[model samples]
Target: MANKAVKVGLLGLGTVGGGVARLLMEKRAELSAYLGVDLQLARAVDLEPARAEELGLAPGVFSSDSWSILEDGDIDIVVETVGGLEPARAMVLTALNKGKGVVTANKALLASHGVEIFQTARQQGVGIAFEASVGGGIPLVRSLRDSLAANRVTSCLGILNGTCNFILSRMTAEGAPFDQVLAQAQEKGYAEADPTFDVEGTDTAHKLAIVASLVTGAQPRLDDIPTEGITKITPLDIQFAGEFGFKIKLLAVLNNQGGKVEARVHPALVPHDHLLASVEGPFNALHVNGDWVGQVLLYGQGAGRRPTASAVVGDVLELARDVAAGVPGRVPPLGTQASGGRRLDLAPLDDARCQYYCRFAALDQPGVLASVARELGSFNISIEKVTQKGRQEAGPVPIVMLTHEAREADLRGALKKIDALPEIVEPTVVIRMA
Candidate 1:
């Protein structure tokens, strides 16, 4: 089996698919040594005929329909990179039904329909490996689900989306606005042409959902996990957070508090020395808190053509090794679940108790401070520090306050009273001092 070549069928020969094909064509011997089996790209599928020919793929092997690739008699494994729910999901189901192993990078599909897909594969006794779906090519999914299987993951923190991380990191680094940095990321191919999914933080939410399911032994439904984006992070707020010894990073946080799992994605403040605070640029970092390992940080490039393709091929080799060595059930079903595990509720946007950093424009009245403090004190939220800055010509002087651990709802309630005060010229800008 060490010298045996395994045939592979690929769906979608786009950027990532091209890289997978390139590896099979050029790096077969290199991969063979690692997996103990030669890998062959037996067939490739694409929607465009000219595009397939443009890449100089074999004449007899190209198919516009991906199902034809899955049904290929000679192919043992199917690699899905077409993305989206429609044909990609249908194609993967067909391959699994046919007892052919599968590898995919579709986070949305996996997050939404993974329970059914994994159940089907588990019943059929075939593998569905998806290491590339989460952290680009970092292999965090396998690291948590396989390497750290012995330990219980107490919580998982991630800055998952490269685009969101890049934009936020840039806004903090260059002091450029989100829109400006986003335009630059789009130009650099770090952001998509549409960029909605990446910037809105739903992309991180989807990835986190998958991570939660893989780590918790339960399929995490997307609706159960809440997500927040970085669009509202202002440079002023960034500066304010910096004064308090923190760096803002878009974080996907999943925690097991008591027994309930809470998943969220948002801009969070981490102390400069925290491992995740240093994950700058377009790179991703996952800080997994295991009961035994305590904490492990996985960081690297989270997206790319070759990097993503490298993950897909790694899945191919993993499946090939299992088939060649008759290793049964060593690889768990992709995002598999246990019967007792349930989808945990998403922590409300304003439920958790976190230190608050808020700034407001207030009239420099002597009694104004007392009025503001009373409002927050009603909710049992106390101010730790208050700094009144120079007056502004347009309104009251700016008052910056750092609060002790306070509920988000309490802060929201107090802000309502403060906003209505004549002393307060404008609304408050608040962020969690994570």
Candidate 2:
């Protein structure tokens, strides 16, 4: 008897879609042998069919309209790699309604509409696999959903966005400014022209929200999470951080305190010897700490055509195997029970407790440090170490302070009072030390 053929329909032919198509064809024999099922590409949909041709796809396999795939009877799996929220959202929902197992690499859509998407899949008794959404080919989602399923995830700290990481890495290494390195990242194709989403920490926050929802089973409100960008970081700050045994990296943080989850994104001063601190350039690393599993670190190329394609195709194979075994919805879309009804409180940023690296550009006159210290002491924000850089004579002197563990609220209050002082020349730079 001939092998059972699991037909797949691809809904996008962009970078990741092209890579998935190539991988499916190139690894057909290996995948078929491993899954004990033959995978076949029935149709590929893209606004530009020329991308399919550019990838050397067969003439009959590519189409300009997605309706053909959505309307097809033979497509058992629909892979959607379209990045945005629009047509991609409509296509994924429609495919699920049609009883087709869907695989997607749309993080933005999933972050914003995951509850709706998962609910639809559950109601329709179909499967949706999104391993490619969070960490590209790093397998972080599978680890959280399957491998670490037994443990109570305590916290997840990661460098989730490559563009920000690359820019920060360049700035730290060369002691260059943010604009220079950002321009370099854009020229090298690591950053987008606008780069606002990635640079402003929105991208990292989106990934953090997804990871938090999956691990805690409590879908969080994305807007409530406090977010900060890396644009304020300067080479002088980087130099000061190094002198204090810390490196600044854009971090996505999700921590479960008691039962409430804290989700935030910002530039943090990581100790130089920390594992996440070494993750440089346009790479991503996630450090997940669980009660039973202890610390687990996953690192890899976070994005790019083939890297992301590896994850997209992995989801396809899993879906194919599940369909062939007649267990289409064996695992839930989030690999857990539906959490749409669960309300996870996002801990306010002011409640956080951590050490801080505070830099103040103040007048060289005496009592400047005394005034700042007095205000900090008023809030019980005791300093662990304080250093004043050599005077430049013409400009405000730089005073860097590393504080012991202090409540974020106290630190902010003290900084606000100090900033109002006439002696303070520039806005203080307050970076949390992890």
Candidate 3:
């Protein structure tokens, strides 16, 4: 029989999109031989036509109108690297509805409107592969969906955002303030000019929602996840964390608590010996705990053109093989049958229990520690260690404390009462312990 021909259409020609195009075109012969199908880069759509010239794509391959690719009957798969909700979502849905397979790295779109997209793909009997959405080239989604499918995943703790991880790692290494490190990250292209999503924990939360949904078979609302950023972390906090034998990281935490799932993103204090503590600088790590697998750590470059494109192309080839065989939906978008797994409820943040690192700026008075301790004790929060460093004759001094495991509600209540005290000068800084 003649080898089936599978054509791929690219929706964007930006950094990641360009990489995907280059790979698909450069490795066409090898890919075709591997899959026993003629894998072709059929069409590329981007607002900037100059991108095609820059990438040296053939004359007829580039088009300004997206409909050329979307409406093209020969294209068997659509690769959407357009990173947003509006046009990308609409375009992806259109492709799936047309029975064309999809490959995307849009974490935000997947996290926000995944149910509708997955349903559309399922109804059309096509597939949607999104390996690059979460951990760049780490293969995390596939590992969770295929490799660890036999094990019941109990928890997932990840350093999901490369921008945030870079900032935090710099802060820890140089003892620089948050603002300075963030500025450096932006200058180095690690962060955006307006990095609200990455710095404020929203980016990590989006990735967490996707991973949690895959683990529990329930689509979690992005707003439901409590997100905390690294904006307030200072050099003093990093120094104090080191003194306590811990390193600070912005972590995306997802735990399957009985039938309820706990999801949150925030700066966390990880012990020095823990594997996650060693993950630094534009790197990503996911520590997944499964009943049978015990503990699995998937670590790699979280983002960038080549790494992200590597994942996107891998998904393209996988979906291409299925397309060539005329067998779509061989594997569901999220790894499980849409209606197969039980939906898990989201656990409230208030009920979360963990040790905490609290920093208080208070008047350099002898009675300040006693007053703060009394308030924390009132909420049933016990301190495991306390350190009062440096005395500012006129300004407030630093009081850092490490607390035993306590409910988040009780800790918040204690901090609220303590912040209201006459001796306290600034709001408390709380970093959860892993």
Candidate 4:
């Protein structure tokens, strides 16, 4: 039976480490039966071997030094759940060079040094399983990389970050503000010590870049993806969006326009009826549009102990099986080379047009509306409807303008000029119409 036991070396015993212990203990027989290989935690690598044992390490199998396992001739697979770039990067690189298959859930590591790691693995003739990198335990990365490999992906978009989504959902549901909801989320451990990555959209951007690379085989630079956060999204804005039959969502959108791809993240006005809008709570969802599969929505836990650990273990099993079968060099969800890939600006937004919702508060004065409309017309932007609200409880009078389809640059330019107007009471709230 090819010794139904696959000896695995594990790295890091954090929250996910404990979860991996539970999963390996519980699902060992099932996994072994499935692959005809007993997955054993042959060696565990952690800073403090005692702490790793605290998580219930099997007897006689422990290592304070991860290098021992990396160099251990008996180990068949290396499962790295360690989150970071430096040591994780060096560790994965070393293991791959040693011709050991690696399985990891480090999105940051994968996002930054994926091409280098993937190419090295290819050269070493080993599989690198990272199914949990994008959608936590959802297996989306593997699906995109293997199952949908043949399909020509048209658009990849989603609410990929849980922290930001939770805050935004609270702002919409309870009519609460951003900072307040954010504080609560932090208190609840939904946010990080430095929530900048999650709130500022960089986290989602990282996932999008990885997904884009997988779909396009071209690793796009992080800075190339134009990103906007949800910090500016107000409760009133969310309310108005709902009233107008739209739901607000922070979406990381990737589109393949001809030979190029455009990746961007921003607070968007998605129709309530659309599946993305229905996604609520501290959950993550991805929408992949393919020529063959059409459109598929994958929704699940974006992070945390068991979910992330399950993904890591799943990757571990895949690597174990692939290595045993002597079929290594499995490509990642994204086909990334160390240095050959180049990112091309897709300029896809220009191709996809939409109506815009603008809120401009001007003083109670005549010719103000006409002047604002005229300024928008300069860029060939047309206003479909103009609604002048009576008066705000505080501040300037409110003037909401709904504009017809126009390019984003034109809309932005028109808003900038309107902001400079003397008649305008305050800065406008402009959101893309659903």
lDDT of candidates 1 onward, in order: 0.81, 0.89, 0.91, 0.80
lDDT tens string, model 1, 1-434? 36566788988878888788787778867877777777777788887777677767765777777778766766888999899999778999899888888989999998888878887778777888888999988988889877898888888889899998888888888888888998999999899899889887889989998888777777777877767788888887787777778888888888775556677777788889899998888999899988898889998889898888888888888888887776633466744445223444556656677788778877777877888888889889898888776765756676778899988788899899889988888888776665
Worst 10 residues of 4 by lDDT: 332-341
Could you estimate the TM-score for every candidate? Answer: 0.93, 0.97, 0.97, 0.92
Off by over 4 Å in 1: 1-4, 334-351, 363-366, 392-397
RMSD of each: 2.3, 1.3, 1.5, 2.4
Off by over 4 Å in 4: 331-354
- What is the clash count of model 1? 0
Order the candidates by lDDT, highest first — what do you get?
3, 2, 1, 4
What is the lDDT, from 0 to 100, of the residue 274 in candidate 3? 93
**What root-mean-square deviation over C-alphas does model 4 reach?**
2.4
Give me the runs in candidate 2 sitting further than 4 Å from their true place. Answer: 338-341
Candidate 4 or 1, higher lDDT: 1
